[model samples]
Target: MRGGPPQAEQPDDGEGQAVLGTGPSSLYAHIVNKDDIDGLLIGRLCAQIVLPEPDPDAWQDQIRDVCAQLRDQYLKYPGVFRAALAMMPTNLDTLRVNEGLLAILLSGGIAPRTAAWAIDTLSLYVGAYALERSLLVQRQRREGDDWVLSRDDLVGRFEALPSDRFPQIRQHAGELTAGSGHDRFDFALGLIIGNLAHA
Candidate 1:
C-alpha cells in the first residue's frame, strides 16, 4: 500500500507484481484479477480500523473515533481510498467495519434507516477527503511547483473577488479559510454526528 505512485496512477498488474515480488503468472496463481486485488487491499485497510464497543452515552465520541481511525488509515497510504470508491463493501472486513459503525449510530438512538444513511455519508466523506488530501500532498511534493494554496493565499483570492458580487466572501475571507490540519474534518463530522440524537 505504501510503495508506488498514487494508486490512481499505478497499473494493477504492476502493483501486484511489485507487492508480491513475483511475475504476473505467480500473481495470477493467487488471485483472479485486478478487481480481486482491489477488494483485498480495501479489506485489509478496513480490517486495520479499530472499532469501539457500542456505548449509548458516548456514541458521538465513538463515531468520531471510528471516523478518525478511518481517515488516519486512508491518509497513510496517500491514495489507497480510490479503490474504496470504485467498489462496494463486499469484503468481510469492510462489512465488519460498517456493522461496527452502524451499531454505534443505532445505539445513539438514530433510526435504523438514518443510521444506515449516516454510515454511507460518513464513508463517502472520508474517501473524498483522503483522495483530495493525497492529491494535495502529491502536488506539494512536486519540485518548485506546489498547487495547493496557503490559507492566506486562498483568503486573499476570496477577498479579491468582485466586492458587490461576493460581499460575504470578502467580508468573511479569513473565517472561510481558517482551519488547519483536520479541523475542518472534525467540524464536518460534528455536524453529521452531533444531530443523531434528534435524527
Candidate 2:
C-alpha cells in the first residue's frame, strides 16, 4: 500500500476504502474507478497553480515561474505525476494551465505550433523531473541511506576509467556531474526556452 504512484493497471480498492473509511460500495458511489480518482487528484493539483498574467516583455520569466510552480506542486505529492502521465489534459484545471503557458509563449511572438509543442515539452520535463525526484526519495527511505551516487564517488569512478578508453569522461568527470539543487533543471529549461527566441 505504498503511496507513491497510482497503479493504472490495477486499482487498489482496499486502499481507497481504507482512506475513506468506507466499504467498496460506499467508495464507488462517489467515484467510478481509480482512473476517475486520478483525474480528480490531478485536477485538484493543477487548480492550485497560480498562473500569472501574460507579459509580452517577460514571457521567458513568466514561463520559468509557471514551471517552477508546477515543479514545486509535483514534488509536494511525491510521484503524483504518474497519474498525469497516464492521461491527457482532459481536466479543466490541467487545460487551464496548458492554455496559460501557451498564452505566455504566444505573447512572446512564438509561432502557434511552436508554442503548442513547447507546452508539451515543458509539461513532460516537469513531470519526469518530479517523478524521478520522488523515486529517489523513496529509494533513500527504503535503503536507509542516500540512493544517488555521491559526486565525489561519481567523479572518482569516472577518473578511474582508462584514459584511452574513456578520455573525455576521465578528463572532465567533475564537469560532467556538476550541479546542485535545481541547477540542472534550470539549465535544461533555459536551453528549451532560450531556443524559442528563434522560433
Candidate 3:
C-alpha cells in the first residue's frame, strides 16, 4: 500500500500546464498515495495483452482479469484510475510493444481478436484504460446493485416506492439507465463508421 517512489500526482490540468511543455515538478502541490496495483502484475497483464494472435474466446477472460486488476487498483483512496495517467510521462512514442509482447499475452490463452483489440484499440493511448474502467464499473454495479429497472422503467418504479423520503433519488432516477448496451454501442459505431462514408 506504500513505500514506492512517489509519482507526480496531478489531474488533467493541460490548460496552461501542458505535459509536452512543463515539467510535473510545479503543476500543483498535491500528492496521491501510491496504493496502486502491483506494477509487476500490470506489466505482466500488459505483456499478456497486445498480442497479434489474441484469441477471441479468451479475450473476454483477459478483459475480465484486466478489469479486475483495474478495480483492485481503484480500491485505493483518492483514485486509482489516475495510475495509467501517471504511467504516461515516459518515452511513450517509441515504446516498443511488439507482437512478441502480444504473443506472450496470447500464450496466456487470450483470443486472437481480443488480443488484437487489446493491442490495437485498447493499448493505443489511455483508450484502453477507459475500456478497463467501463468494464470495472459495470461489474462493480452488477455485483452490488440490484436495480433491474432501466430509465424507461424507473418512472413507474419510483412512483411505486413507499415514501417521499427519497425525493431526490426519485426525481432523477429515470435518467440514470436510459439505453441498452447494444443500442448505445451500435448507434455510436454507426455514427463513426457511417461518418466515414461521408468523409
Candidate 4:
C-alpha cells in the first residue's frame, strides 16, 4: 500500500497488475466500481466468521472472541484495512458482523448509545492496528536485507535513558519492548472488553 497524507487519494492497481498483467481498467471489467471491489473482498473476509449465539452469560467472552477474529480478518487481507477506515459496511457479510457485535453488546445490558459507540471504537482500533502492520510490511519490502535496528540496539537505547529525567521509562525499559504483536493486541483487546463490561 502507498503511504502518504491521510487525505491522499491513491489508486491501487497492484492486484490487477499481478493477476491480469495490466491496469485497473481490466479489473474494472469484473468489479463495477471501487465500492464493489471493497464489498467483494470484505465479504470473503467475513465468510467464515462464526459469531457466537446471543447469550448474556457468555457475552463478554463471545464478544472478545469476535473482536479478535475481526482484527485478524482485517490483517489477513494485505492492504484492505485502509478501505475499512473510509467505508461503512454496505454488504451482507459486513452487515452481519456489525449486527452480531451489536447483538452481543445489547444482550449484555449495555446502553444502546454505549453499544453503538463501542462498535465504532473497536473498528477504529482494528483498522489502526492493521494500517500500522501494513506500513511495517511495506517498510520491510522496501528495506529488504538492510536492517533498520537490532533488538540489542533498541534495548541499549532504552537502558541508556537518563534515570532521573525518565524514571518510569527507565524502570520499565524491558517491559516496554517485550511482547509479540499478538501479545500486545490481545492485551489491548482484553482491556477494551473489560472496560466495556464494567462500564
Error of model 3, residue 24, in angstroms: 26
* Estimated TM-score for each candidate: 0.85, 0.84, 0.29, 0.79
Q: How many residue pairs clash in each candidate?
A: 0, 0, 10, 0
lDDT of all the models against the reference?
Answer: 0.81, 0.81, 0.42, 0.73
- Candidate RMSDs in order: 4.9, 4.8, 12.8, 5.0
lDDT of 4: 0.73
Per residue, candidate 3 scores C-alpha lDDT tens digits across 14-116 of 3223322444454323323333222322333343333234454454444434433333433321232344444541222213343443554566565566555
lDDT string for model 1 (1-199, tens) is: 4333223433343643443356655555676556666677778778898898999999999999999999998787665678788778898999999999999988888999999999999999999999988888888888887557888888889999999899999999998888889999999999988876677
Q: After superposition, how far is residue 73 of candidate 2 from its true place, in Å?
A: 0.9
Ranking by TM-score: 1, 2, 4, 3
Better of 2 and 3 by lDDT: 2
Q: For candidate 4, write residues 42-147 as lDDT tens digits.
A: 6667766899898999888888788788778776666776767777788798889899999999999888888888888888888898788777777778846455
What clash pairs does model 2 have?
Answer: none
Model 3 off-target regions past 4 Å? 1-41, 53-81, 89-149, 153-178, 181-199
For model 3, the run of ten residues with the poorest summed lDDT: 32-41
Measured on C-alpha atoms, candidate 2 has an lDDT of 0.81
lDDT of 2 by residue, 1-199 (tens): 2334333443332433432356655555676566666666677788888998999999999999999999988787765677777777887988899999999999999999999989989989999999888888777677656547788989999999999899999999999999999998999999999998786
Backbone clash tally for model 2?
Answer: 0
